[model samples]
Target: MKSALMGSLKFQIPQLNFHKTLKKPRPSFLRGRPRPPLWRAKRLSTEAIQAIQSLKLARSSAPRLEEVFNNKLSRLLKADLLDTLAVLQNQNELDLALKVFEFVRKEGWYKPDILLYHAMIQLMGRNKMVEMAEEFFGKLENEGLKPDTRAFTEMIGAYLQVGIIDKAMETYERMKASGCDPDKLTFRILIRNLEDAGKEELVDCIKKECGKEAGGRFFLKISSAQNGKVAVADLQYHVLKCQKARNFAVSSCEADLISTLLKLQSRRAHASR
Candidate 1:
C-alpha cells in the first residue's frame, strides 16, 4: 500500500511542474508612480545657481542689485534672498542688504518676519547706525509687526553703545510696559551697564523688579497672554549659554527714572494686539 502511494505521488509531480511553468506573473502597482530626479538631491538648478552668482556680483551697486533681483524674481526663492542678505551682512555691506531687503519687501511674494527684522536691527547696531535702528524699530511697530524680546534687547544695547543711557532705559521701560519681560541677556546688559556707570541703586532696583533666584540661576517672568504664569527662566538660561559660547559681553546703562511697576501694568492694560 505504501509503495502504491509513492507511485501515485511520483506520477503527479510532472503535472504539477508543468502547471507551475504555465503560471502568470503578478501585476505591479508602482510602475506608473513618478520617481524624483536624481540630480535634484545633489545640487541646485542651473537657473538658481546663476541667480545667486548674479546677486553676489551685483552687491556693489544698489541700482544694479535691484535690477538683478527683479530679473531673477521668477526664479529666485526666499531662501536665496535670505542667503544673499547673510552674505551682505558677512561682508559688512548692511546698506546693500537693506536695499535688497526693501526690494524684497515690495515683491508680491514677500512677507515680513521677526527673525529677519532682528537680523536687520543687529546689523544696524553693529554698524553704529543707532538712529537708523530706532527708525527701523518704529517702522516695524507702524507696520503692526511686534518686535520680539531679543530685538528689544538689541535696541537697548544699541542705545547704551551710543552713550544714550536715557534712551536705553526708556527702551527697557517701553518693553516691560508692553507686557514683555526682560530675558537674562536683558538683565545682564542693563545691570552691567548701570553698575559700570556707578548706578548701583538702579541695578538693584531692576533686579528686584524683574527677577528672582531659582536653582542657582536668575529668572525673569514677563506678563504673557496667560497673565504672568509663564516663566522665561529656561529660555533666559539657554540665551546665556549661547552668549557664553559666542563670548557676548554684558551691556550697561545710565538714565533718569520714569515709571514704576504700576505704570508698566497700566501700559499693559492699554496695549493692543
Candidate 2:
C-alpha cells in the first residue's frame, strides 16, 4: 500500500536556469573580472563612494583638506554622512574625518553618540594629540553621557600607549569606580604594559585581583595522577621555562623576586610563631 501511494504521487522539479542564478549583473561602465568570495566584501554606501572619489580629487587638485567637504556633502542623509566618516577613518584621513565630524555636529538634527566620540578620541590619540583626546572625552562627560567599557578601555590604552602610566591607572580606577568590570583583554593590556615598565609588584597585585596566579594561571591545573603531585620547586621551574619560551617581556628576575619575597615572609611568620 505504501509503495502504491508513493508511485501515485509523482513530484516534478521546477526548471531553474542554474547559469543565470550563478551570474551577477555587471554595469556596462565596469569592465573587470568578478571578485570571488563576495560574501566577505562589504558594499559601500552611495555617499561613502562619492566621498571617496571627492577625497581623491581634493587630494590631487585642492590645496586644502577642507575643500573636499562642501555644503552638498553636509546635506547628505544622516546615515550616509556617518558611513562616509567611517570610510574616511578606514582610509586614515583623520583630518578629513574631523572636518566632516564638525560639520555633522553643527547640524540641527545631530545627536551625540558614544561610538562617534570613541572614534574621535582614538583618532586624536593615534595622532599623538593627547590633549585633544582628553578634551573630546571631557565633552562626552559634559553631555551627561555615561561611558561604556570600550570608552574607558580606549582612554586607558591611549594613556598607556603614550607612556602615561599614571593617567592609565587613574582611568582604570575610574572605570572600576563607575562599576564597569574589566575583561580579559583589559587585564592583559595593563599587565603587559606594567610588565614592560618593570612594575612587577603591580602586576602581581593585578593578577591576584583577577584571580590569576603569579605565573598567570587561570586555575590550578595539577596532573596529580600522572606525576603523583608536582613539587613547588618543579612547578616554578616549569613556569619559568614556559615564560622564557613565550618570550614575554615579563622577566624571570621579577618572578624570582616574587619567590624570594614569599620565602622571606614565610620565614618571618615562622619566627613570629
Candidate 3:
C-alpha cells in the first residue's frame, strides 16, 4: 500500500511542477498584478550624476545652517547627508536634487531637519508639487525635529499655494500646538487663503481674529454675490469652493441633502458638475 501511495504521489508531482512550461498563456487576472515602480532605487546616468556632484558644498557654517544648529548644536543630524541634499535643492538643480534625496532617503540617512525640510518646501512650493510638499511638512514632528517659525511659514505657504485650505489651517493649528506662536503674518496669510478659497465665513472669522478692520473686502464680496444671486458667474467661485470641500465617498442621507442644497442654490452647478 505504501509503494502504491508513493507511486501515485510521484505521478502528481510532475504535473504540479512550478518550473514546467505552460501549454497556453495564462489569463491576466490569474497571473496576478504587476508591482509598482519603486521611487527609491531609480538610477541616474553619469552626466546627470556629475551635475549633482558638481553642486557647491554647503559648509556646516551657513546662515540658515547656523540658525538651526543654534537650537541644539550638540545634536547633529545623522552626519550631513540631508545637508548636502538641501544644497542641491537650494541651487535649483531639482532633478538631481530629487535623485539624491531619493537615494539618501532609501539608505535611511536623510532625516528632516529644519533647513533640509525648508529647502524641500521652497523647492516643491515653487515647482507646484503641492501634495509632496504637504507630506514633507506633515511628517516633521515624527522625524525628531521641531519645526521653527520659518518652517511653519513655508509649509503654510505651500498648502495655500495648492489652495488646500483645510491642510493650511491644520498646519497652523499644529504650529500653535507645538508651542510656537502664530504672528500677525500667519493670521493674515490664513485670512487671505480663506478669502481665495471662497470660504467667506472663515475669512470673516480670521478677519475678526486679525481685529476686523481689514475684513471689509470679505463682506463686500459676500454682499455682491448675494445681490447677483441668480447669475451663473455670481456663484461660480463659491460653487467650486463647495466642490473642493466635499468628501464624496459617503452614502449618508445628510451628505446627499447638503450636496443637493448646495447644487440647487448654485447657478454654476453645471460647471462644478
lDDT of 1 by residue, 1-273 (tens): 999999999998887776565657753211122334333444555664576577778878878777887788445676666565655554557766787778667767777677777767767876779988888788788778987788898898777666678888898988888878777567767877777788877787776554231112323344444564664322233223333322221221112111222233344457633
Model 2, residue 111: C-alpha shift (Å): 1.1
How many residue pairs clash in each candidate at the backbone level? 3, 0, 0
- Against the true structure, what is each candidate's TM-score? 0.55, 0.58, 0.40
Clashing pairs in 3: none
Model 2 regions lying over 4 Å from their true place: 1-41, 59-67, 212-273
For this target, which candidate reaches the highest lDDT against the unseen true structure?
2
- Kindly list the per-residue Cα lDDT of model 3 for residues 88-185, writing each as its tens digit: 66555666576556555556444555776776776776666888777777666668777887688677877777677787788877787888865545
Ranking by lDDT: 2, 1, 3
Off by over 4 Å in 3: 1-92, 102-112, 211-273
Q: Per-residue lDDT for 146-196 in model 2, tens only?
A: 887778877876786677988988998999899987765567667777888
Task: Identify the superior model by TM-score, candidate 1 or candidate 3.
Answer: 1
After superposition on all CA atoms, what RMSD does each candidate show versus the true structure? 20.9, 17.1, 17.2
Clash pairs (backbone) in predicted model 2:
none
lDDT of each: 0.63, 0.64, 0.54
TM-score winner? 2
Model 1 has how many clashing residue pairs?
A: 3
